[model samples]
Target: VWHKCVDIVTAGLKRVAEIGTMMPDPHGYRRYCFTPLVAWTADLPEQLMIACVSKSASPVTEATHKQFGDSHSHSSRTGDLTLQRIEQVARGTHPWNNLSRFQREAKTIQLSGVHLPFWRNWPFADPSIFLLPEILHTCHKFFFDHVLSWCRELLEDDLDARFKCHHKRVAVRHFAGGVSHIKQMTGREHRDIQRTIVPMIAGCVPPRFLRAIRAIISFIYQAQSPIHTDTSVKEMESSLQEFHAHKDAIIEANARKTRSAGTKNDFHIPKLELFHSFAAAIRNNSGLIQYTADVSERLLITHCKRPFERTNKNKD
Candidate 1:
């Protein structure tokens, strides 16, 4: 329970002088506090945050200082245009990630939140789609690392913290184990699956490449080896670290409350208990440091996959 003035914020003080001061609100402060840990939290697109801060600043001059900032007089023309660029990007990339156009036309498709933003942009729609192989490779490696890391721990409970990669893309992921090899049999079978899944792949590939990927998934589901993805193992770790930091913030807040008010805040005491319970839940879910099956299943089961898979066959 940190008192309001306890200043529990403990991230990116180093870049402070460069990015400019945070807005005077709690969320602004929270976002500012979370900045250095971006590699860890993996939240917000690059450059967009600087844009967000600029947008949030109450007085335009203060916002300008926060944006192009650390530059000469806030009145100067140089900082104005420089700060304006980030806004331009956010505005431009908007359509790339949203699927409403297709859905509105009765496409009636659902893209995963993870892929939705990406699909709204360029490479995702261009069919000439770049990074197909990279995406596959990364997904495969992410699953493999977490699965093996998990298996090792199961075989030897003496160990904790099994993941190794600290990269951004993969660490934020949740990959189900064992599904790596499950494959569809026919081209038609895969075609149907593709109709359903291709959108989730974030429109990040050409039709021809997407077809090829479907073939690969089918073959592997029926075979032994696994296909990888473009996302890195490091990303998964980064996500967990971010999650932990968030959890830690909640814990700190509760601790501060207890100290700040003592008996003065009895009316809201139950809310405090609920907050502690929430923090405990996150702690119980302590993210995997080395990949593991249990964690993988928990993380990978998205909103779409209501009938989640749990095959003990994977252990074999």
Candidate 2:
């Protein structure tokens, strides 16, 4: 199924390439000569990865294969590399070479001719290039889930008890007890924090904490900007460096508070390393990375769900 899909897509691309070559523009500008490139973007979802790599063993698929399919599946095995091992193996370095062993092996996928890995070959550009760090998922995990959540924990009680609006004959209970006890904020709640709480607490929290928030938000906003250039990439790198420095300082100061507060949880934030990976993705192919964010997918899913809800098919 995977190879078939690849063949169909590649065949279409080949025809397009041929037509592009044959067609001539009046101004001698051949727009069709420009080949199309594509990348598949998704969070590291287990089942999706299994399907992409053809490791799933569902009975329906097995049954369909048994009756009519070729006896051999495409090179379906990687000696010892499993999906779960990728993050550990990659070590936040060259995502293509370090993450997928098979992708590294099939360094270049030709649009024409035989595929080295018969089963799963990329039809467009190299799979390594196609794999991108989704900003919506990755940034949210780092900035909101990890960084903001930790900040909330450390500041919530204090903010609730002490921080007040400027015109403070009245107590501002916007965050009465700080956000520490609350679970990770929802997307809407996170926005509310940015809109309402960020300015409110700017003077209250350490300058470094505010700087970190601003830095992360700046990177995210810059990434979403329509403008693309080397300068944007450099800007993101600079933002990341600023974020890292401020993050380390905040963590160091919080270390003592965590120790004294009798909390068993460490101040460590998960997937902070992915910022480097995300930046690398941008460095490798900024144009492609721009399109890989999860914003479109989330919107598409919401659009698709509405019809199901209207038909009462989505009722729980």
Candidate 3:
């Protein structure tokens, strides 16, 4: 159903890409304008759906959960390769020409059974390439979801006490009741927590674990920079490497846990794997700041929420 909706929407885009449209420039001179999908800004789950890759597999790289924590770079996943895999499933013969077999084959390649993706027919649009990183969901949400949870497990009541004791300053959020009591946290709150979290848990967690937290915090801040250079990007990558190096301390402290197995510990986080593509994304698409969802989130409150509130509750 979702793919059908995508097909309906992209049909026009496909036509526009093929037959160029004429538009005026700043000087009012009419010129042929060809629209190609340069970048797609979405949260990780939506990105996986649009790119037709499974959660365990990355759309940007060939790496799966097993290789997610590995420091080595993985081979890129290309549109041509994705299309070819879909084609193979569609044209399978004999024993492979069944629904179960098709699903199994697709799973092996970390692809969903989305045989005909909307972007398949679109010109110069590669899902792997165009699906850019979003800082809000990728960094801020991950911190709250994984990092904060890990810290909470290790620190427990002490964590909250530290936050409660921290002196309040101008422009800084004061979590008077501490983080655990907060029902819902906004992006701004997440940013506020990031600012103070490293020092808040300094003496409580192991030295290696503290280093890991510090490194990830560094990476998150660096990624949000409005301007990025080759040197800056390398520094970002180094921070990620540093985090990966010391992440074992998290497991040793019994902070990280597997939801499925309940006892096993591993760093098979999709967001962690997604970090590997940030350098390439920054180089390909200008700065990471441009891809942030902050502006759009604000616009949602202004354009959607406010208007809905203003509207009368009627069928009309």
Best by lDDT: 3
* lDDT comparing candidate 1 with the true structure: 0.27
**lDDT scores in order:** 0.27, 0.48, 0.86
lDDT of 3 at 149: 82
- Give a tens-digit lDDT track for model 2, residues 1-316: 4545556757656556435444467987655464444445665442124233332221112211122122221232231222223323344444444435434432222111112222133234433344465655656545556556545555665554443333334433355444555665555455445444456556767788778767777776666555577888779768867776676546554622343454432333223433444444566666533665456666776887666767858466
lDDT per residue as tens, model 3, 1-316: 6877888988877888989889899999999988888898889889889888887888788888888877767888878888888887677722235767777778777888777788888898897789998999999999998889889889989999999998989988888999987757889999999999999999888999999999999999999998988999999999999998999999899988656665446787788888989999999997887888889988999998888887895546
Q: Tens digits of per-residue lDDT for model 1 on 72-174?
A: 2133112233324333443444434554542232211111111122212211121111101111222233223322222222223221111122222542432
In terms of TM-score, which candidate is stronger, 2 or 3? 3
Instruction: After the best TM-score superposition of candidate 3, give how far the Cα of residue 88 lies from its true spot, in angstroms.
Output: 0.7
- Model 3 regions lying over 4 Å from their true place: 93-101, 258-263, 301-316
Q: Lowest summed lDDT over 10 consecutive residues: which window, candidate 3?
A: 88-97
lDDT of 1 at 100: 55
Model 1 lowest lDDT segment of ten: 124-133
Candidate 2, pairs of clashing residues: 156-177, 156-178, 156-179, 160-176
